[model samples]
Target: MKKIFVLDTNVLLHDPQAIFAFEDNEVIIPAVVLEEIDSKKRLADELGRNARQISRLLDGLRDLGHLHEGIELEGGGVLKVELNHRSFLRVQEMFGEMSNDNRILAVALNYHLEEIEKEAAKQVVLVSKDVLVRVKADVFGLKAQDYLSDRTVEPSDLYSGYINIHVHPSIIDEFYTYRFLSIKSVPGASKLYPNEFVILKDEMGTSKSALLKVSSDGARLEPLFLSNEAVWGITARNAQQRMALELLLNDDIPLVTLSGKAGTGKTLLALAAGLSKVEDEHKYKKLLIARPVVPMGKDIGYLPGEKEEKLRPWMQPIYDNLEFLFDTKKSGDIDKILMGLGSIQVEALTYIRGRSIPGQFIIIDEAQNLSKHEVKTIVSRVGEGSKIILMGDPQQIDHPYLDTVSNGLTYIVERFKNESLSGHMMLEKGERSKLAQLAADLL
Candidate 1:
């Protein structure tokens, strides 16, 4: 049935194109949502960018007809700017508030009553990214739903990039002797992706095993190229880290993604590989690192310093990993080493847009806080001979509209799994410390 979807301000901010997502359903943009968008249009952040995009989209739609009445969208639906002035009267007696949330709720309530009076067989559903808004809509006896059109995959079904198979003892021996195996030799291996890691074990519950990776053609399995190599004084401590290292150090794969919980060494491994490629191997001219600046708690407001000082708090984690890789003992020693090398660059993700990056080993840490559009922008900026690594913990997403499934890191993993130029690995073990791993698991 065709339903009327009342959009909250956050839904539009999260995705300006969300109005066209609901197929053949009428989209109602509350007047308060437009006001909120206007208020945020002046900010110099991703939110402001989205607000401006929404304004441009609405302006483009104005050529069709009056938005106050309705505009016929390209899809088989209508877009209307709902201008109800009911002032939250229906919800005031229950939960009194004149906030935008309540005002949006009033718009939905007024629409519901009009539909009921007209005896229309249609549903009025409030669509929002805010859980509290949905709950309050329920309290007012209205149907509500989360805007989920952007999620690429569910968290449970996220790709792990590797699989284990029980094979005959003879096959393991052949892989060990020849150091290569054909995909036809393994059962149910047709679905494997390029650069995917595989663990072949003896079927008799013995300890004989072989670790291999799918070749670029996806037709054969080869031994891991960097399994025994130490990157920037950090050796792979587990099987998953070894797989990640293989992908990270391989020059053929232009893009690599690593995901794990805190203390799993995702950032550490990426930094190690980047340092080796840029400084040790001279494969890339510079090592560039950046991350999204999503605040965990109440923001510390603005810092009173220059660019480097302003970015110190956000980029300190990256500096710590760099310090470990460079083995700097004293304070400011890492800064001295970086100055001497003249081949390292660190910046915030905000300033990376509109710049084409090339000939650098770029690492984007904490990528789970980026939206799909932001990820596309970053990946599209990579130039020839440049390697871009996206590492993040999907479970530790700080983006309000993004979750494990919808974040940019998981989106890249799912979208580029079949491409030969990209590879992914999920780091399962934490090597930082036992206490940190315990906190990650138990607490």
Candidate 2:
């Protein structure tokens, strides 16, 4: 049956193209949603950019017909700006507020009543990215759903970058003796992707194993190219970390993604690899590090200082890792070290837009807070001879509109799993400290 989807303002902000996502379904935009979007059109962030894009889209639709009267969409569905259904008495009495959310609810409720009166087969559903909005919709006895069109994969089904295969004991021995194994030798290897790490375990149920990575051609599994030598005094303490290091240090692979729980050394490992590539190997001219400025709790707004000073708080995690790599002992020693090196740059993600970064080792930390469009924009800016690493914990997203399945980090992992130039690893063990690991696992 054809459905009627009432869009929340956040849905549009999260994805300006969300209106076209509901296939052949009638899409309704509450007048209040347009008002909210208009209010955000003048801001300087990603929200403002999305608001403007959606506004332009709506304007383009105006050429076809009046929006309030309903316009035919390319997908054979009607798109309408619901102006007459703004009656708020129903929600106002129940919620005791004249807010925009309640107004949107009122529009949906009026639609529901109209559908019922006409005995229509169309189902009225409210789609939103806000949890509270969905809960309030349930309170009104309306069907509410999350905006899930942008999710690349379900959270449970996400790719883990590596898999264990129980092979015969001789297969492990062959891999050790020859240091290479054909994918045909492993069962169910037809689905293996380029650069995917494989752990060949003993089929006899022993602890004997060999770690190998699929070659870029997806034909053979080869030993890790990284030697036993540590990068910048940091060594992988776990197998997952070692897999991440192999991807990070391999210049042939230009893009790498690392994800893990808090204190799993995602940032630290990336920094170490970047520093080695930039300073020791001279493979890159500079090491550029950036992260989104999303705050964890209540934001301490309007921080004072220049651009670098304002970015200090957001980039402190990067600085701490850099300090550890440099073994800085005193306060402000990192500044001195960075100044002397002249090859490392730490900046906010906001300033990276529209700039072409070349011959640099770029690390985008906390990438889970970014949207798909944002990640695409950043990655597309990479110039010749540049390598970019995106690291974050998808489970710990700070973006209100993004979840583990929809965040940019996980999106890239799944989308580029088959690409030869891209590699990804999900670090499972927490190596920061015993307390941190315990808290991550238990608390």
Candidate 3:
């Protein structure tokens, strides 16, 4: 059945092209949505950029017909600017005044009533990114839903990419003597995938903990740090961490995606692995890092310097990691390391298009801001022998259309999980600081 999706401001703000998403279903944009977009159009950030894009879209649609009269969309759906959804009576009865949110809800309620009266036989679904809006829609007895444009896993079951195996005390001695224990020999140990991580704990209740990698074959369990004979002073805090480490170290699994909230150490971990692999292991030719210069509310156009100078702010995080890794003695020490390493290079994402990168460790930070199409473009640029690490938090995505479930990062995570050549981990803990962790949880 064709559903009448009531467009929310947030839905459009997150994605200006959201109108094209629901196939063969009519999209209703309340008058208030236009008003909201109009108000945001003057701002100067990502939201403003989207707002401007939406305005342009509406204008382009106007070329076809009056939006109020409904414009025929390309995908067999009509886009209508609804002017009749207002209900001052309903508004005063519930929240009072024509508040933007309440007005949107009233629009959905009015549409639902009309659908029932006319017997349109179409579902009236209110789609909003705001949790409160969905809850209010439920309270009002209307069909309300989360936009769900960016999520891969459910709120709880998002893949951690690793499992903990509780094994008999007998396996402990075997793990040390053989240096590589087969997963089958451990009771209850399931066959792990090529890039999977496993933590084996003693069943007899000793603090005996063993972290091992499930090698490409399900048979051999190789100790992770055996290649270096030294620890990096960083250990897995969660099962997800083990998964991340596995991908970071594995030469075969080339595309890796990490998503987490602030202080999750996504950038730190990716940089550490890149440095270790490129500088120490010589697995890759060089380390290359880049980020989208698309600022929160400003265009790449606002910058007034050479490309390198313009990219300095956006690339600061990568440089910070390089500085820390090289233990730079003073300011500008990071630039010295990049020059010394000779192989490691930093550039902007804009330069990435039309360039083939091979045999290098590439880290793209803030990848959540990327659209699905943009991500595909970047990934397709990877040549043989190259590994690309994409790290970003979907929840905090700055792109208007992208969200926790709908952005490119999450898209890659969900789509590539089954591939033996790709791996993903969603970091949950923040290693930055106590206050940062607390803020991430509370706010």
Tell me, by lDDT, which candidate is best. Answer: 2
Instruction: State the lDDT of candidate 2 residue by residue for 1-443, as single tens digits.
Output: 89999999999999999999988999999998999999999877778889999999999999999999999898888899998684688898899988888888888888887787775557899998889989999998899999989888988888989999998899999988999999998886778999999988898999999999999999999999986668899988989999999999999999999998999999999999998888889999999998887722223357887767877888888888888989999989999999998999998787788999999999999999988888999999999999999999999987888899998889889999999999999999999999999999999
Worst 10 residues of 2 by lDDT: 293-302
TM-score of predicted structure 2: 0.96
Cα lDDT tens digits, model 1, 1-443, are 79999999999998999999988899999999999999999877778889999999999999999999998887889999988745577778777878888889889988887787775557899998899999998986889999889888877889999999899999989888898999998886778999999999889999999899999999999998865767789999999999999999999999999999999999999988888898889999999999877832223247778878888989999999888888888999999998898999988887788999889999999998988888998999999999999999999988888878888899999999999999999998889999998999999
Q: Order candidates by TM-score, high to low.
A: 2, 1, 3
Give the alpha carbon lDDT tens digit for every residue of 318-357 in model 3: 8886776667789987777677779878887877878999
* Regions of candidate 2 where Cα sits further than 4 Å from its true position: 295-301
Misplaced by over 4 Å in model 1 are: 85-87, 116-120, 295-301
Per-model TM against the reference: 0.94, 0.96, 0.73
Residue 34 accuracy (lDDT) in model 3: 92
Q: What is the lDDT of residue 137 in candidate 3?
A: 87
Q: Provide the lowest-lDDT 10-residue window in model 1.
A: 295-304
In terms of lDDT, the poorest run of 10 residues in model 3 is 225-234
Superposed by TM-score, candidate 1 places the C-alpha of residue 326 at a distance from the truth, in angstroms, of 2.2
